[model samples]
Target: MKNAMPRTLDRLLASFLQCGTWAACALIGAGLFVGTKVLTAGVALFILLPVLRVVLMLAVFARRRDYLYVTIAATVLAVIAAGCVIGIRLGPLAG
Candidate 1:
């Protein structure tokens, strides 16, 4: 039971990431073929993927009842969010 569940979770996570990657690529390609706003959305998805991955990690740890890891993951997520906000505030670095 224990071994089976963890393996299942791992597989689920892998499948989620794989599908997400493929979907994002398809959107980006279609955007390139089509229009401006679609291309912008595709680019936004590319930016959001890492943050989404961290959120997924936080959910996984929380599900497993691993409090310490949950805390660590949450902290990491917060830092990422903060960095994004700071970057937006600062605007372009070089030009």
Candidate 2:
């Protein structure tokens, strides 16, 4: 049972990533014919993939009552959030 749980979570995470990637690719490809909005959506999804993965890891750790990992994952998420907030505040001009 213990071993099975990790495998299941791994599979779930893998599938989620795969689906998200494919969806993003499809949107980008369609956008080539449709417009910039769809392409932007795809780009956003690509950027968000890592964040979503961390969120998934946080959820799994929390569910398993793994405080150490939960805290680590939470910290990573906070950092990512902070970076995004800073980037937004700075705006394109900052770059």
Candidate 3:
């Protein structure tokens, strides 16, 4: 079961990325003729992919009762979340 988990997760991650890419392409391509909000939503989805991956890992590690990995993943997730919050609050910076 332990060995099977990684393999399954690997497949799942691959599928997730594939779908995300298609969604992004559709959104951006259509947005080109639509408006800025659609384009922005697509860009946000692309940017969130890595963070979503980390969150996935964190859940898996916690489920496996790997405290060390859980801690590491949680810390990383928190940092990323904080950066996202800060960026949203800061808005566009001037030169």
Query: Which candidate number maximizes lDDT?
Result: 2
Better of 1 and 2 by lDDT: 2
Global lDDT of each candidate: 0.81, 0.93, 0.86
Each candidate's number of clashing pairs is 0, 0, 0
Tens digit of per-residue lDDT, candidate 1, span 1-95:
66786787778778877877777788888888898778777777777877787788789879988788789989999898898798887777635
lDDT of 1: 0.81
Error of 3 at 70 (Å): 1.9
Candidate 3 ranges beyond 4 A from true positions: 85-94
Tens digits of per-residue lDDT, candidate 3, 71-91, equal 999999888889878888777
Give the Å error, residue 2, model 1: 6.2
Between prediction 2 and prediction 3, which has the larger TM-score?
A: 2
Candidate 2: clashing residue pairs, number:
0
Worst 10 residues of 2 by lDDT: 1-10
- TM-scores of the models, in the order given: 0.79, 0.86, 0.77
